[model samples]
Target chain A: MRVLLVEDEVRLADNLAAALRDGPGFAVDCAADGLSGDNLAGNRCYDLIILDLMLPRLDGLSLLRRLRARGDSTPVLILTAKEGKQAIIQLLNSGADDYLAKPFDLGELIARSKALIRRGKGQSHPVLSALGLEVNTLEQTVRRNGVLVDLSPTEYRILEYLIHHPRRVFSKRDLLEHLYDYNWEHHSNVIEAHVSNLRKKLDAAVPGAEPVIETLRGRGYRMAVGPEHTIEPG
Target chain B: MNQVKRSRSIAFHLIAAVLAVELLSSLLVGILSYGYERHIHFHAFDSILHGRVDSVIGAVQDAGDVDDNVMLDTADLHVPKDDIYEVFNSRGELLGRSPNWTGTSAPPAIPPHRHATFSEIKVNGREYRLLTQQGSRIVDPGDPGGGKLRHVTVIYGAPTERLWRAIHAAVQFYAAGSILLLAVTGPLIAWLLHRGLAPLRQLATLASRVSADSWHFSPPASARTTPELAPLTTAMENVLQRLERSFTQQRTFVSDAAHELKTAVAVVKSSLQLLGLRPRTQAEYQAGLERTLADTQRLEELVAKMLTLARVEDTGAAPGLPATVDLVQSMQQAAAELETVAKLHKIKVTMESPADEPVMVALTQEDCSLLLSNLLLNALQHSPPESTVELRTALQKERNTAEFSVRDHGEGIDPADLPRVFDRFYRSDPSRTRSTGGAGLGLAICKAVAERAGGSIALASQPGQGTTVTVQLPLTPNPDAASQLA
Candidate 1:
């Protein structure tokens, strides 16, 4: 999964980004000011946006308002130091999916970020299962027929993104934007290599199991949909 | 508990004064009217007595005797029943007398030149007014060319009891009128005064409602227009507005302080939490520990700055310290103390003074150092590498102030951020300043220190040229004495 972070405090942003990247294996992109954050959010397709209220150039509320005005429905998780119920309610009313006050536990932030990303794709549970393959979003692990499956962080993220949107076909560009942040150099073939590796792991996990991932010649990739691979609710 | 004595209301005092003056004037009027009435009554009584005596003389018509003497005619005399009279001829022979005449003192003989004489007498234990007069009668008007003069004396006396009673009645009427006037007007005056002072009472009620939470002060139109209350109403509005502004400033400062402290703690907490997320090699763990230590150090710095700001703000009056501090010396020491920081930033810190004489200010040594250090540090932080930060001091003799300033040739503050540069926890560029471990309390502390010493601090900056922060402190009146004591 991919996420964007907008915070004025450099150290706090760095720490949070590191936590999200290591814990949830999310491709994290950071913006230090509200103006840049707005620009990045407007142009990029992020599954989740972590916003800090007190930002330079423009405040977080105005950015959120502008984003919502343009009909960008990316799930927003607000980080605030303001200790008041009124401020929290205002943030939520301003198109924020959730909020966490500052000095919050790092573990809680990661958990909530993953949950919001999952819910943003119309899933409610932390684990996504399809074609006898179970992807635990919280633990960043995958299992085939109740057995552990070893996968690279990149492969795990691609599988997680594909599983969240079960039957949607994602082109190479879509996969690149969804699975990688700005820090990564995007080459069309990079998505191909990661997808190929992810498919190999899934097939190798259970030799007789049906294919969990499907590829169309021109339409790119989608999760395999058949009688054998039934998509669970979450 | 000590009970405060409630003073009399203004209306009460005013009404009492008016009533007192009215009572005194009424009494004066009563006395004056009584005296005037008595004079008129006495004049009328005298006229009646003259008329009665003349009638007695007329009745002394020719007795037809050969001597041509006048005799009293009791039938022709007409007077009050309580009156008495005595008649006599020129030879001093008594002709006739009133039956009530029983006094031992005889009436005085009328003077030859005087026509009448009047006096007050007490006869038979009764007060009487007596009139003695000389008169003449024409005994033979047809024989002589005019008339024959027959001289006679008549004494008439009337009791004065009725006159005294009439005068008393007039005085009583005046006294009763005065009492009635006082009774009617006393309450009228009090009610009028109370009504007239309504604006004052309304102003008091409105002023009493002012508090810390609510600064609403809308004086009634009556109070605003009243000549006596306009000034007070305006003064109260001005005071309340000033207090509200100060309260808002304090509230903003407190919230900003809380935000900064919380953010700092968050940075430290996240760093430690990130380090504990997974097992790592010894080298990776060592690097993570160092980074976490740095984050904690920044947190410690933020807490220390906040404390310094609080301490500087809480300083009231003049603390017990050296009476005077030399601005030139303080500047030099501050520049030297920040030498390492200046070196690290590749900036040169220089000091300039117009005179060799010490510019002594009335500030404590610690406060002087604090003000100088904060200004120098801020200047150095904003200055570019290999640039110069100038520290200047001068004694402004005309204004009686000691001026110290720091000038840096760096990227100056934007016009928008200039006004709030000294506000607590307000940073011009949050991301840039946060990386440098600036909590934005340095300039705030400098301002507090300057104001606590009866001084003022100001900033002037250009976007590209540079920025200069100046502090002016009141000069000590007896600098030499203070230095000697030190």
Candidate 2:
């Protein structure tokens, strides 16, 4: 899943972004200040936005307030050094999903981000289940009926996005945004390669398997969850 | 709503006081003035009544014939409209009376040859003033023969309603006048008070704008300025100055602390990332672990110093922490404990008084140690090798004060930077502060400890010369010595 991180501290933000991007393969876009973060949030789509309170042009609290006022329901997690109860209560009342104080561990930050994204898609656990198949988010592995199946990282991420969000249409731009960070120079065509490869791998795994990740021609992609005759007895 | 309450505002108090005094004095003056005016009018009216009596008697005597017959002439004398009279003979027989009294109710017949007297009589539901003139008079004015005098009594009755009417009118006018004055003066006094206190309102407006972020404070000028508000404005300006200074220091403390914490965290994070980036040999892994341990150790020390700074700054002269301790003893103990560090650095530490005289202060023993320890540590670390750090203790007996002063000979601070040397995280050479293992919070803690003990700390230094730091605390006398003296 992709996320947006808007924090002012350069070193902390850089390391956090690197960890989210290369470590767990969460596509993260970093904005150093509030105004630019607001602009990027409004123009593009991100599954979750990590906001910091103090910023250069506009403050994070006001940005969150304005963002929610415009009816954008993207889950927001606040990062702040302001420990006052009044500030926390106000931030929460102003539509903040959760908050973490400064000097927190990067690992804890990543876990919280993933949890928010998972809950936003209405999933119950880190492992997504659908179509008699299971995708393990933590192990980056896929399995059909208790048998392990190999998949590339990119293919796993795209399927991971679709498996978590079943029966939803995602345009190529949406898939690319969900899979890649804002810092990447993305051509929407890159998502076509990953989706087709994922479709091929899912069919090849079974003797006579239907395409699971179905592309709705001229639209985008949706997880195909249709009633089948039966699973072949192996 | 009509009930009165004790007001807290100065403007309300002033206006109420002025109105109360003015209202009471106005009522008194109005009553006195009305009574005086009536008294004067009554005195003048009495004289006029007596004159009318005398004129009527003269006319009667002049109209008298050779016989004892009284002929009253009422033509020449113009009697008042409200006056009535009657003349009586010696046998108490009525001879003549005024024309106004001919048909009206006659006054009572006063006895003839009685002394002239005046009285009040009521006739036909009206009050009259009666004057009885009794004396001897000639029967005929033209007779040259000496004749015996006849005693005649003249009873004159005058209506008293006119006098009361005049008095009533005067009293009514005075009451109306007082009511008018009260109505006008009440609002006038209120307006005057509001105008008088306008300067104070301006001062409050100016003071309210003084915040931690915005520090501009200027007293009101021109129309809003007054002599009575000058001292108040000056006091507020001084308070604002103090607040601004503290707020600036707090902001600096925050930024400096945040930078220190972030740098420490970044060091450990980067070190771990570099080690975990690729596979390494067992020895290299051990070396990397040792480096990370060193960084973590520094981080722990930094956190500890920050906590010490916070505690020292937070401790007030609280009831839970009150204990009287000997200052010299604490200072000497702290010095003795730090002697190892001093020896390691080749520094000489000496105390002027070695517990010979008890110099007591108002802080606890541990607090005194903390203050002295921080100061002495700062002095020792800044001093050159083989240099001397002297500890001096003295009691200013008259002021009941105890002082602990630390003097260090080192490459002293520059003159321009001397004032900020006690600031938290202040380093003369920013690069060497961490290398020297000083978080720059030593002197700041020393200042805080001294202040929390109800004392003050001062520092003086010059470039290339020695520096002196002084902690002056209020002295508390030993109870044993005091009891013996008593």
Candidate 3:
């Protein structure tokens, strides 16, 4: 999953971006001011955006309003230092998906970021499933037939994106956009290599298990769906 | 504990003064009317007495016997039953007397040359107004030209008890009229005064309702237009507005301080949390620790600056700090302390003054040093490399003030930011990082120190030219120096 962070404090922004990347293995993009944040949000596609209320050039509320005005439905998680019930109500009413006050726990922030991304993709549970395969989004791990499977961070991110949109055919470019931020270089062959590794690991976890991923000719990939796939409670 | 005396109500005082004047005037009118009435009644009584005496003399007639003497005609005489009279011929012998006369005191003897005399005499223990007169009557007027002329003296007296009663009745009438007038008008005056003073009462009620939490002051329209209450109403409105402004400023300051402190703490906390996120090599760990240490130091600097601002504001309220420090010496010490910072920035800091005399101002040494250091540091931060920051001092003899100014040749402030530069925690550029810009409390502290010492401070800036801050403090008079000069 890819996410965007808009914050003004240099150290706080750096720390939050690092935590999101390391904990959940999600690609994170950061904007230091409201104008640039607005500019990036308008031009990019992301599953979630973490915004700070106090910023230079344009305030957080104006940027949020502008984002919503343009009908961009990306889930926004607000970070604010202002203390008051009225301010919180105003933020939520202005299309903020969730809010966290300043000096928040790094662990909690990462957890919430992952949850927003999952919900943004219309998945209710923390763990996404397909035909005997289970991907735990919170821990960034995979299992097939209740057997743990080891995978690289890139391979896991590709598998995570495909499982979130089950049965939808995604081209190589779509997968690349969803799995990486602006900081990463995108090459169509890179997506092929990661997906190939991810498929081998899932099939190897249980020798007799059916394949959990399918490739359509000329259309990149989709999660394998069958009567055996059932979502588990988080 | 001392008890405060409750002030008297204005309405009560006004009513009392009006009633007093009414009662005094009533008494004066009563006394003057009584005297006038008595004088008129007495004059009418005297005229009636004189007429009665003339009637008595007319009753004297000639005696029908030889020797030509006049005799009193008892049958033809007419007078009041309470009156007494006597008649006599020129021989001084009594001819006749009234039937009511038991004259224990003889009428005063009248001189023959006098025509009449009137006196108040007591006869038989009763007061009388008596008139004695000499007159002539014609006896036998049928004779040739006229009958023989016979001169006679008559004395008549009337009891004055009824006259005294009439005069007493007149005086009583005047006193009753005055008392009645006072009774009818006393309450009327009181009610009129109360109606006239309604605006004042309304003004008091409105003023009494004002408090710090609520600053609403809308005086009654009548009060505003009334000549007596207009100035008072205006003064009260002005005072309330001033108090509200001061309270709002205090609230804003507290909220801003809280915001700055919270942001600083968040920075340090996030830095530490980021360092502990993953296991790393020893070298990486060492670098992370050093970065976190730097974040903590910035937080510490913010907290210290906040405390300094609070201390300066607190002491500013209490007066009478000893003005023992020499301005020149304090400036030198401040400049010396900041020399290393200037050297690092590659900026020149220089001091200039017209004279080398010691300029003593009303401030303590610690406050003087703090003020100068804050100003100098601000100048050094904004000054460009190889530029000069000038510190100029002078004694303004005519104004009895010691003046100093700090001028920096750097990028000056925007006109919009100049007005709020002395406000606590106000930064002209919101994007300036904490490392490049101090916590924005330096100028605010300098202003507080300057005002606390009975001094004034002002700032002037142009966008491209430069910025200059001037401060003036009252100079402490030196008696020994003055004597030496003399």
- What TM-score fits each model? 0.87, 0.59, 0.80
Clashing pairs in 1: none
By TM-score, the best candidate is 1
**Candidates sorted by lDDT, best first:** 1, 3, 2
Q: Give the runs in model 2 whose Cα sits over 4 Å from its true position.
A: A1-234, B1-30, B61-82, B90-93, B98-116, B134-137, B140-151, B188-196, B222-224, B277-281, B315-336, B346-362, B383-409, B454-476, B479-486
Q: Which candidate would rank higher by lDDT, 1 or 3?
A: 1
Task: Identify the runs in model 3 with alpha carbons over 4 angstroms from their true place.
Answer: A1-10, A13-17, A20-137, A140-234, B1-5, B50-58, B63-101, B109-190, B276-288, B315-321, B324-326, B355-360, B394-403, B473-476, B479-486
What lDDT would candidate 2 get against the real structure?
0.77
User: Best to worst by DockQ, what's the order?
Assistant: 1, 3, 2
Predicted complex 1: CAPRI docking category: medium
Q: DockQ (C-alpha) of model 3?
A: 0.44
Ranking by TM-score: 1, 3, 2
iRMS value of model 1? Answer: 0.7
> In candidate 3, what are the lDDT values of residues B346-430, reduced to their tens digit?
9999998766588887777788999998899888888889999999888898999989899999899999888899988777765
Clashing pairs in 2: none
Query: Could you tell me which 10 consecutive residues in candidate 2 chain B have the lowest summed lDDT?
Result: B477-486
* lDDT over C-alpha atoms for residue B412 of model 1: 97
lDDT of 2 at A84: 65
